[model samples]
Target: MKRIVIALALVLCAAQPTLADKVAAPIPIGIAVAQTSNVALFGQEQVNGAKLAEERLNAAGGVNGTKIALVFQDTAGDEAGAVNAFQNLLNRDKVVAIIGPTLSQQAFAANPIADRAKTPVVGPSNTAKGIPEIGEFVGRISAPMTQVAPNSLKQAMKIKPDLKRVAVLYAQNDAFSSSETTTFQDAIKELGLETVTVQKFQTTDTDFTTQVTAVLGANADLVVISGLAADSGNLVKQLRQLGYKGLIVGGNGLNSPNMFPVCGALCNDVLVAQAYSPGAVDKNPVNKDFAAAFEAAYKKGPAQFSAQAYAAVQVVVEALAKIEKETGKKIADFELADLRAALNKSLRTGTYLTPMGEISMAPSGEVQQKDFYVSKIVMNPDGKTGSFVLVSE
Candidate 1:
């Protein structure tokens, strides 16, 4: 009879789910970004940054020995794709947080899903206006155009003190570019430069002869472009090829090394507003460590996209760690809803020393970054390699 009872108890224990079955060893965090499509140029860098962050954080003991596993979903550069990715992350993978959907346009489309689901999200590269205001659960590491764009214009004006007749160009379909052009236009007016012409293009555009012609016909002294790496770089190439050269100031969208492949030697001396510069690694311990680890892993210098992505992952992990300390329980043990709420609160309460410099979010979910810069692109003699050399103090 005792043997029978023991056998029955063993059977019951086996039938019930085990801890391993209920909770995965490495908790999953969703990384939704463009892995295919034209935006992949920037999205690929964001993927690299998130992967490096995952490995580094895990190596650092991983939120008190609870490892973080990243699950990537490609948004494919469209609003519908971004919405689908966010839905999968929220309903299927059940991630504690999400970091991605690369562009501000995607953020505008997909963030509401996460907001409705009460999931915490961090924008790695969405820099347009009203991003954070989507919801309390939404926050971003990218500073707004207001903080980063004006400095580039100021630097450009200093370079050509009498600069006038501005021709502004942007990717009309992109939320960030469309909004960024308005900021650029405002800055142009504020600086007392004439708005000679405003031209529009799409992110998918390759032939920019019409826009280039307009810029030249207007005889603008400074050309301000607010488009992504590919379109903006091509515009720069066509502008240089057609022989319009006073000063070219690219908005936040052009702050990528990927621009080199499109513009080549023409990338030289282009002024771009930057939120992160590789040289900044020298001043901050966190930046120094991230740069070393990122280079060791990728064999390349980390750009602003990568830096911001890394910072986003760090924000999530750090918040998870804080919850672990406050609750006296492993993060994996917390109820998913409770954890998400706690994370949203934790993300806004502290300052982080990131590769982008010291960053803290305002109550409204805006990132209050301490450093903003304007860098001039210096293309290699080979014409296919380049870097942003910081020019503004």
Candidate 2:
């Protein structure tokens, strides 16, 4: 009888759940970005940066002892694709938050879905004007067109104080390009410069002979380009081929190193305002470590999009950890309403040490930082491409 009772007690005790078994599953984060398309170069860099953040967060035991799993969905740089991607992430994957849609146009479409679903989204590089106006759910780390375009204009004026009669070329169909063009136009007017000619093209259009000819005929002293890498590169090449060799200023879209392959020798002497410079003399350990890791993984330096994506993920993860610490509940347990409120409050007050530099978010979801530099594309003696001489603002 005693043996029988002991055996029954042992079986009952074994059937009871252990503390480890009660632990929650890992949190799921959705990464909606343009993995393939004209923006793939920038998108790939953003993914690499986000992955680095994931690795670091996991290595540190993740947020509140729960691992974070990044689920990726390609937006394909289109509105329909972005809507579908966001739907899949929210309905099927059931992610806690989303982190992309690189282009501002895609964000304009996809972010509404997230807002309606009450899911938070942090943009890695959506710099179009009026992005945050989508809703309270959308936030971005990249500087707006209003900020970046003026910086480029200021750099152009510095290079040629007498710069006047500016020629502007942009993709009229692209939201980012349109927004940037407006800023460039306003900046030129503010600087007391004349707008000689304005040329427009669609992103799908390849040949820019007519626009280049118009710009050349306008006899402009400066040419400003507002388009993506692929379009911007072609425009630069065509502009140079047309023999208009005054000063060239590129908007944020032309800041990528990929422009080298697009414009080749034509890329030389083109000035771009940069948001991130790995070689910057700033004494931040986070920047140094991120730059090294990025170079090792990507075989090249990280761009502004990469830095912004990394920073966005870091901020989200930090907010999740803070919520868990305060409430003692997993991220999955928090209601979407409460979570969004907490996220906004936390992001505004929290300081993030990103690859770009330390960043703080304002109440309006605008990133606040004092770091913008100008870099010129110059070919090395070996014919390899690189940026030289960081100019202070």
Question: Against the hidden true structure, what lDDT does model 1 obtain?
Answer: 0.88
Report how far off residue 194 is in candidate 2 (Å): 1.9
**Whole-model Cα lDDT of every candidate shown, in order:** 0.88, 0.80
- 363 Cα displacement, candidate 1 (Å): 2.0
In terms of lDDT, the best-performing candidate is 1
lDDT of 2: 0.80
Q: Candidate 2's error at 113, in angstroms?
A: 2.1
Per-residue lDDT of 277-335 in model 1, one digit per residue for the tens? 87775568898999988889999989888989999999888878887887788876777
- What lDDT tens digits, residue by residue, belong to model 2 across residues 96-149? 778998888889889999988767788888887778889877778887777666
Cα RMSD, each candidate: 8.0, 10.2
Top-TM-score structure, candidate number: 1
Candidate 2, TM-score vs. the true structure? 0.84
What is the Cα-based lDDT of residue 268 in candidate 2? 84
